[model samples]
Target chain A: MRAGTLAPGKRIRPLLLVLAARDMGCNLEQRAVLDLACAVEMVHAASLILDDMPSMDNAQMRRGRPTVHREFGEDVAILAAIALLSRAFEVIAIAPGLAALQKSEAIAELSSAVGLQGLVQGQFQDLHEGAQNRSPDAIALTNELKTSVLFRATLQMAAIAADASPLMRQKLSYFAQELGQAFQLLDDLIDGCKHTGKDVHQDKGKSTLVQMLGVEGAERRLRDHLRSADAHLADACHRGVATRHYMHALFNQQLAMFS
Target chain B: MRAGTLAPGKRIRPLLLVLAARDMGCNLEQRAVLDLACAVEMVHAASLILDDMPSMDNAQMRRGRPTVHREFGEDVAILAAIALLSRAFEVIAIAPGLAALQKSEAIAELSSAVGLQGLVQGQFQDLHEGAQNRSPDAIALTNELKTSVLFRATLQMAAIAADASPLMRQKLSYFAQELGQAFQLLDDLIDGCKHTGKDVHQDKGKSTLVQMLGVEGAERRLRDHLRSADAHLADACHRGVATRHYMHALFNQQLAMFS
Candidate 1:
């Protein structure tokens, strides 16, 4: 169960979580913050496990190796994914030194991110992206629901751990949302141009940012998102500028690759 | 998502939760208890969604109709099941009139029941049950983890909601475990003989109590479980007698069918 998550990966979710914790002036190594980071990473891995299943993407490789379902049988992959998901919640619930109210809040935030109106619905939309018209607004909504919300959840869980106010939480959510959109757009560009991953042509029917916005238009949107994320960070956290610097350094690498 | 759960079925788990709540002197109509009942039902439905997938049991029909995967396609079914799961936790986390401690406890209990050493592992064992020796202990452990633990979780969640004592919770766990084993054994017998549900013959390779013990022996063991459950209830609940009566009435109907 832990193999998929503990395997080599970028772990952007966990990193963002720790960054969010830092933004709130909390210790980066706070037990609750650390555990929540692991929780989101595990949840993210579980999602990938499902997304890579034969019935879904049919991808034979991920995280630079055979996907879980490919390495193990489909049965193990499914069970392991579920186990990871449940464990993610357990990690939050049993995190040492966390208050009960905050624990409950974190659970609620995570559940809301993954449940009916969040990842599940987003995945459903993505699956049908080919059948639908996939208008720019639809594509954006799909990206927001499918990707941004989980990112929002990562930061929001951190905010709860730090005892951040509701207003601060809202600003952090906006910051995460922009970051998530930019991340997905960069992914699409990479997949489209480099064909480094799965057969990108197989997903040709699905709408992508590069297809919706011309290459230049998509780059413009990515920059706009970065600026929005910067503004939200400045308003939301005491360490906003520092966080923005870290994010810019990270995004710049992707942007360089995109261009 | 509710559509899947609200579909007609036995709904024994949620029923047991409500009864357990009543046994603890809690109002069955309380919003928290009621929402939790719905939550358990939703989780059960979600499990069915996965269990019926072609990769797993390949069950074409469930709940007297086409299974979710068969009806809505595999991707939708998977997403819908996950949505139900997250929705279940959300229901508990946001449940009104519940204390933070109890809510967190409930989440932990439910997650543990569904996580690494629980349903996931149990399902893995079931897939390999025939490959292993299929000893009585093996079969029993498989049933305990896959089925009984969830039943235990249902009662455990109810105990938390009712503010029941540790001792009371332990007793309820035992009651649920025995009840769960008995329920599965009875189901095996029913499927073995009557063939009312899925193609039981197709599952002949799977270990079952009816196979280990003769039908008569399985029935005997079920009776033993009921007696054990009765003992636990007597020592556990302040209103044990009434709860026992309700269980007896319910069990009798099932026993008559099994016979």
Candidate 2:
């Protein structure tokens, strides 16, 4: 579990959670925020381990290292993934300073994001439909399930922690939806380029937005999503300069590789 | 998930939870008790799916049918297991009439039972050390991890639901521990018998109490455990006549097969 989670990688989901919590004016202790953040990251890490299994994506490398199953054997890897997932809920269930209702709500959100309506469904779709000729709507729905559900869960958990107004939570939900699409599109673009130090051509045979739109068209769609995401973020957190700046820098660093 | 969980089975863990809750005078709605019971059964079903995988026990049959992976492929089987586990937590989190603190405590107990200190650790030990020359104490610890931890969690969750006194909770804990040990030993004994209608000889090469003590000696130990468990149950629930009757019938049914 440590090897899969603590290895050097961009903890984008947890960072998004922390930033959103701060943007929502969450006044909880830093420890509470950090624990929630870690919980989100643990879920992400667990997904990656399962995804890289021989029966799933069959990827041999992750984070520039042997995948968990490759390093630890499949049984241990599966157990580690489960351990991480269970520990994630355990962390939130016992997190200090949060109200019982808040913790319960957070656990509900996180578990749903990992269950039938989220990662499991997303992965099932990817495995069963990636090579098939799929409609744009189908592909987008898959992307939403694979990426945005967790993003929505992350921000919604932040909203719960902060006791944000319903309207603010709605805006953040929109923001997460748009940002998650843009991020996945950006990843698709990166997968096609050889100079990005990533595992290139991962989507070589898959039906993706980039496959339908080409690199330039995909880039245009990505920009549209980013613009929409920024608008929602602005509406949700007018004074969230740090969040805006960090998102801007991160996207620019990846998008610039295309230029 | 449905195929794995809703299949015909004994559902001993969930039954234990329901019985314990009733014995503790839990006055929550029947739906709440049913939901909690289903959650425990879901967790048990999820563990069985993983344990039957090709990378683990390599078992081809479960509950008298082709194992999940054999029927649905390993990837789908894995996702189904995870979905079951996640849904278990979700059920508890959203269970009606449960106070937020009660929900949180139940989630903590259930998660720990599935995580490092519970199922994962127990499965790991079984996979890594099952065939080794382990000491009696080490073997007992493994049995406790694989069996008793969830039993303890089930009863503790019931205690929390009923708001039982700490003294009553302690007695239930002791009751669950002894019951769980006896339950595991009985399973081992049945595994060695050819006429039990079970998938016999599962522990043919594993280091088990039955292996160390022989069938008669193991039966003696099981009797001791059952006696101790009854004593604890008597202490825990003086008026739990229904629970005691059910346990007595279940055990007699299994043990009679040997006679």
Candidate 3:
């Protein structure tokens, strides 16, 4: 019954959301913004619980502890995940200090990211695809749905909350997708290079960008995404000194993890 | 995945929601009402899919067909359920021709109905309770949370959509809870009498009212609830001839089913 047992992994999604708000000159600690961050992390945690179920990845360990299903049984794991998803919307709806329309906008943003065309479809593809038979394009699409859509959602929600311009929101959307892919690629590379006490090596046979591109090619791809992320980060908001510094610090830290 | 594979069983929740709106002089065919109905049913169907999984009910049959998990395996069934939940929210958010705040209200209602204090906690209690260990009070609480709460939500959402007065909404809320319990009681009575091709008989040891209070006592309780339901129906909106006629017809039909 305990959710969020995995601690918060990197909190990249929430951090990106806050930084995106900063880019648009919104206060970082606005109660509504903080609520959105909590809601987003709850969703991420819920997804992780489901993903670790015996029916999904069947991982024995996550973050050096037993997976949720392994610890609480599959039934509780699934129900807890469902509860978290529902609670995320509840969090957004009841968040204080936000206009009514803002609550609706954020709710819409989060719900769409988890529906048929987003995480569910992506997880479906991941489950149905033959480990050795998926094409690069299929793999890319799955990445977008399963791992990246929520990433895109957090940034989009922040932009909406800040009332950024439509063009700026679009730029941030692009930035999110690219950043998501780069994050997954680096994760794969880390797993391929060393054990992570989880299912990382078990998925070695599965098609991934890391396998598709090889180390050098994947590095090149990551660089391209990083550049795109930087450019859009600038365009999505003010590109103030703090925003630039924060983006560089986070991205550079992730990059350094490879060494 | 195929979400509506079970052919949308009975449509009772949506029917109750729409009928509630009709009681308040709302046009039954309004797009917003229709979308709300669809969203309610989707949530019900999603709950059923999970309930039928090997990890939960381990059900072999549902609605006279192989259970979703049995037919498509646990992986697809889980993902499909998740998709349906998300889709329900999406339907509420994007339901055409509704005021923005109305959409937000419905979204909040539905989410809260499914979260830790609503369906999820109810379900957790159901799964965790030993067949013979639950008390009548505990059973009643579980029934309220797991079944009545969602029924309550449907009526509440309908009221919100129709812009009904607070007193009217409260009356409808009471009506919905009584109807939900009555429905579940009748269902249990039917299960006791004959096989429904589902897991009804399999739960003989479970703490249903029929088991806790004998068949005769349970029948009395059901009738009492029907009376309460009629009273709430009168108080909730107005007792127009059509509304009274509709309520009488529905109750008689349900009562006749028991006979």
Best by lDDT: 2
Q: TM per model? A: 0.96, 0.97, 0.95
C-alpha RMSD in Å of predicted model 1 compared with the true structure: 1.7
lDDT of each: 0.82, 0.88, 0.79
**How big is the positional error of residue B56 in model 1, measured in Å on the Cα after superposition?**
1.2
**Ten contiguous residues with the weakest lDDT in model 3 chain B:** B1-10
Name the candidate, 2 or 3, with the larger TM-score value: 2
Ranking by DockQ: 2, 1, 3
What is residue B22's positional error in candidate 3, in angstroms?
Answer: 1.6
Per-residue alpha-carbon lDDT of model 3 for A142-171, expressed as tens digits? 888886789888988888778888888888
Clashes of each: 0, 0, 0
- Chain B alone, TM-score, model 3: 0.92
What are the fnat scores of the candidates, in the order listed?
A: 0.89, 0.92, 0.78
CA RMSD, predictions in order: 1.7, 1.4, 2.1
The lDDT-based order of candidates, best leading, equals 2, 1, 3
Listed in order, the DockQ scores are: 0.86, 0.93, 0.78
**Predicted chain B of candidate 2, TM-score versus the true chain B:** 0.96
Q: Which sequence of candidate numbers ranks them by TM-score, best first?
A: 2, 1, 3
Which pairs of residues collide in model 3? none
